[model samples]
Target chain A: MRRIVVKVWEFPVRLVHWTNFLAILVLCATGAYIHWPFLSTPTTAFPYVMGWMRLAHFVAGWALLAGLLVRLYWGLVGNRYARIGTFFPYLTRQGRKSFLGVLRYYALLSPRLPPHLGHNALALTVYSGIFAVMAFQVVSGFALLGQADPSGTTYLLTGWIFSFVSNGWVRFAHYAATFVMGAFLIAHVYAMWVSDLAERDGTSGSLFSGYKYGELEEFEDFGPRPR
Target chain B: MAHDPHNPRETALEQYLESRGVDRRSFLKFCTAVTATLALPASFARKVAAAVAADDRPSVIWLHLQECTGDTESFLRASRPTAAEVILDYLSVDYHETIMAAAGHQVEEVRRHTMEQYKGKYIAVVEGGIPTKDGGVYGCIGGHSMVDVVTEVCGNAAATICVGTCSAYGGIQAAAPNPTGAVGVGELLPSIPLVNLPGCPLNAPNLTATIVHFLTFGTLPRTDSLKRPLFAYGKRIHDNCERRAHFDAGQFVERWGDPGHRQGWCLYKMGCKGPATSHNCPQVRWNDGLGWPVGQGHGCVGCSEPGFWDTMGPLYERLPNVPGFGVETTATKVGLGIMAATAAGVAVHGVAKSIQLRAVEKKEGN
Candidate 1:
């Protein structure tokens, strides 16, 4: 079978993905340090460790938010694969079938891989959920930060979150979201590797190179299927 | 200083203070203390002094329900001008249920008289949660339910002051499974301008500063969304903790009586809610700046915050569980458990996939 190289991800999508990846990494590490402060300095004068960690967390948080905004913008105007409509697998009969096929493959009840140039239905659904979690992290992060200086700009932006939930619960949700992101990171990497291995396609590499090997027919109807 | 006996405004507060043996200098110092406590500039001290020394002393009606009388006890222990001066001279406390010399029907009569005479002029100070379940039978005063009493008293007051965690945010009585359906004074009387001095036992200086602010400005000081005075309850305890350096340095007290604990390291690990609790306990201290809970080698229970009794617990744990979970479980526990399960699932799936691949390879070779 002749493999066709498909432009699955655009330049903007790849850039945002890598930036978000790095930002999430930094945020998780710094956030954990802020929560538990596992490391201790030799002297009492080293007060800036936690301070620096908090600063890094804030910077990375803003970076992630920027990355999300750019990605969301691209999702509206970018190529077929990058569009937000591609993420909702439940919207089409073919997509629903492919979702079940992918589930069957994961359950070891099927041997054949689901045919897709970009993400399979199950992968798209998981990515959609991950994005939702990321959005929550951003909101909760700002809410928690706003409490630090209630009169500042951050508070003005995020003080309304306190009206719905207490700061402690917000902190809890933030922590829970971090764990979700962490678990998603692990599963996402493993699934990407597995997909690449089983399908003999550039599934993992497509994230970096924006290209994937697939059948030529898969490129047709690239946008979301008409409901 | 000699006062003109003829002028009513000239001699009212000053004369009263002098009669209590508090001279002009002492009274001015008390005013300065109140100004400082309210986080006002040094210039505001004279304004506070003038306000307190004014002839028309504002009337205050203090009511107690479903509380331990701790707020009044803390007030009595205030160092500046003393609690007696605060009640008698500072604001002419017309009827404090705890300290008033009147008994039974006489006290009720006095309260009614003051409320009628000074309608929409006196301050209504509430010191406990108002039970609302079953017509608020859980808490009552002189056969009057707390809900009815609060509604009635606050209806004809200039402003209401919730003087403790109980009245401010329902305190411990309003904790989990709130049998009486107790709620804070703000919940009971949302329309009235209110100030919440939300401590386990309300902070004395906070109450005094709030009263002085009302007397000085003819209105309550600016409050947070929780109706707490911004000046006193603005900053988090963690922000101004004496052991904050230790927290920043990552030196936490792991256990009570440990070397780190004895050496006064951060209590972050020992379930200190200081990081989340917003109060000026560190700055103001308790019992006239003597010491606070964290200062005395104990973590803050976050008694000053709303819903603290329910949400800010497992007092010895770092974080409380997410609200909906049946059993108490920390975020770390739940997060780590889910992550561990995912890791295990991924490992098993990988092994299964590898085995299936090997079997297929063997079958193809055959």
Candidate 2:
């Protein structure tokens, strides 16, 4: 029954979030098929199955890469709350305290929750780490794909990574990383669902409609506002 | 077979082979092949020749335990010029079971006679695994258990060579529950030096090269962990496969008569265990260097490896349940294992999430 006059994650951030979610889902589905092709299907459709899997994997990778680039640009040019400082939690002691404070709250040891006008320092740290890991996956996946095309530039640059990791180890890491990603997905969905349930009015709308209704201090403002 | 310090110029190997009437050219060719197989320096060939010419021919006792005699048959079938015959004779076959004209009591007497005569000077070539289960009842020769015979013979020999998968790694007989409790010579007797030449019916060239190395060096050649000579079993078949180019290009034979199949693409999809198996079959081939399985349009069955008949089976079919996305999709073992784990994890996570939600609602109601 309260209206929040705060901004949390502007248009670009919301757009990146939804697009990346869908892309990652498609990528993981196709990647699993590529990694271990199920033989239960009786059709002689080997070619068709592999082609779509590869196409979807590459397309999703490129989209995620693009989204990352846009986010990087926003990190420098966006508002105080939308800048790299918001994502980088260890910049100041207050940021560190809030980060550790929220972790304790999640652990149920803290009676008081942390406050901020952007991603809680804990959220910022995790999101940044995930981005770094995704970047690694992209590099590794392209290196493997590039082996087929002799003249591919990505192959030339990253083929050494492929050789370095070894085909068996590379494939292992790719598969293992998916479970980590999937775990993050489950936790992420649960958190979103729980947050919506707790706040009720317009809280979940920010991802789809880019706005929400809540108390002034109920949420962190994550972007610029016209004076 | 000691190196003669007395006459340097008249090296021992040259004199010995000359006595056997092998010309200089033939000796040199054999020397070169040895160098190539052992991956020795080119200059080592002359030394090898000198070594062979100088050293007194080391005696060999080729024994037949429980086997189909397929390995000896393979060697005997060696074509014109009969390299197998030449190599066997050249090495001085002090004793053999199938090839020697003497049989029955004379055959048994000759083996015992040679074992006593040569004693620590002869190499014991074992052609099959020793069956120990049921008092080693599965196979016996001359009313003696194979395990007892191998222990008695190999006990005083200079070195032992297991010449087939049956001898080296207990081939088909050792598969699964291993009813016979068959074990290779090395496992049966650990004190003696051992070399394994593992193949379904072992490669004759590999056997010849090992003998040549022993004759040439007056010592056993360097071998890998499996007691396989490094020169022959060092590289995986996949690494040297002629069809490897197709694998790298992602072209695989999905069906018996598909376009990829007709084009002679990689047979990885057809249960070819070449990636895991190691041998020189892809290079040297078989039947006196004529053709191997892949050449006949059938995928490699990985016959050279230990327990291949059991682990690398379902022979003609590709890997079970590999998820293919395109024209030539072949799923590897790691791929299938990972996906199965992922699916299981997701299912558990979903159930946990539902349980947590209900707990949360109960707490709120309370």
Whose TM-score is greatest here?
1
Residue lDDT tens for model 2, B117-205: 88898888999878889999998989999988999888978888888988888877888899999988888887788889988888777
* Per-residue lDDT over A55-172 for candidate 2, one digit per residue giving the tens place of the 0 to 100 score: 8899998898888888889888876666876778888887888888877745545433464545567767888888887877877777656644424587677667743544334554
Query: What DockQ score does model 1 reach against the true complex?
Result: 0.55
**Could you give candidate 1's per-residue lDDT for residues B1-366 as a string of tens digits?**
555577666566677666666677777778888888888899998888887777676688888888899988885765665533543435645788777777898888888999999999999988888899998988778888888889989988999999899998888888889899989999888888888999998677787788889889999999888988899888889988999988877788877998888989899888898978889889878787798999999999888988988877778876667657756667887888888899999999989987787677687783
- For model 1 the interface RMSD, in Å, equals 2.0
TM-score of candidate 2 against the unseen true structure? 0.62
Q: Residue by residue across A103-182, what tens digits does model 1's lDDT show?
A: 99999887546777778899899999999999989988987777777778888888799889776777778888899898
True contacts kept of each: 0.52, 0.00
Candidate 2 lDDT for residue B346 = 52
Q: Could you tell me which 10 consecutive residues in candidate 2 chain A have the lowest summed lDDT?
A: A218-227
lDDT of each: 0.83, 0.70
CA lDDT for candidate 2: 0.70
